[model samples]
Target: MNRSNASRGGVAVLVLAGGEGRRLGGGKPLRRVGKRTLLDHAIERGQQWSDTVAVAAKSADQVGNCDLPVLIDQPGIGGPLAGLASARLLDCPLVLTIPCDMPFLPDDLMARLTAVLGNEGASLASSGGRIHPVCGLWRRESLMQLPAYFATGRRSIMGFAEVIGYATVGWDDHWFVNVNTPIDLAQAERRID
Candidate 1:
């Protein structure tokens, strides 16, 4: 795919791995999926979708030895919005954000998001009648609205998207499985096998 021709100049993929993962016992991105870590799987998916891929992590310690550039979230704030804020520093005109815990992320994620994004300049993935706000394509310029949103004590990605006016692209629910707990990991393992 030629990302350069994307509506917003070029697209950069941002894999959000800054979560504390308390429910999954911590270090969720490092958890193994088959032979590779979840972070590795997310990075692989990011690379497949764009030439420039970055990981938004809380710290280098959390990310381990990832080869791609890493962006640290602004201190004190949490959630995927912080990751998006960090990624806004990148030179690309658009960014596609995905959570590190989603191993079976669709191969056509960018294509589908871009298709619906159209003039709204932002679009998020929806499955099974639920919105997955982190899995989104956004104009880098739109990130300017974040600091004010954060200042107002709002950190929900869906809230931010709604305030900015975004489109939602629907996909099959099975393709959006996320590993948030040990049982989810086991189910993902079975699906992988």
Candidate 2:
């Protein structure tokens, strides 16, 4: 589906591409796995689950060729929370956050998370007993609490989730492998091949 058809279900997909990619020598979103950039792969997956897909990057230049709406993270606050905070600008009631570097993110991620979201306001993805805090679905109301959280100088996505209370949807560990370094990009290339 195209961007015009997205967010029809009251959910918006936010792709977080603001990381410095220090381990991968920077510009991780531009790194290619075959003919496509990691950001391209992420946008593709995001479009599959939501009609209103957007990118949360430090700047529009960081998103490369993807033409989705860009949400610039608030300066001075780092990590996924910044991206989550940027999402508050969206009109949707629910927001799904996905990291750009995870090329193999699950197709059913939104379905599983939304199914269990219930009345608690949020749901996060978990694999092999490890929670992927960035891969979460949050209520817009819950996100309003973030600015205060950032004010306290804390930026833990998991900590924010714990305070809001969230459900966990377990997935296969292999699916969430992220491309944080050159080696990971190479490995992702192999998987794509």
- List all candidate RMSDs to the true structure: 2.2, 2.3
Tell me the spans in candidate 1 whose CA falls farther than 4 Å from its real position. Answer: 1-9
Give candidate 2's error at residue 92 in angstroms: 0.4
Tens digit of per-residue lDDT, candidate 1, span 1-193: 4545454348899999999999999999899988889999999998888788999999988989989899998997888888988977888988999999999988888998988887775899989999998999998888888888888988888888888889998999999999999999999888888
Report residue 191 deviation for candidate 2 (angstroms): 0.7
lDDT of each: 0.89, 0.89
Model 2, 1-193: lDDT tens per residue? 6655643568999999999899999998888998899999888998888778999999888877668899998988788888998999998999999999999998889989999999976999999999998999999999999877777778888888987899999999999998999999999999999
Name model 2 segments beyond 4 Å from true: 1-8
- TM for candidate 1 is 0.94
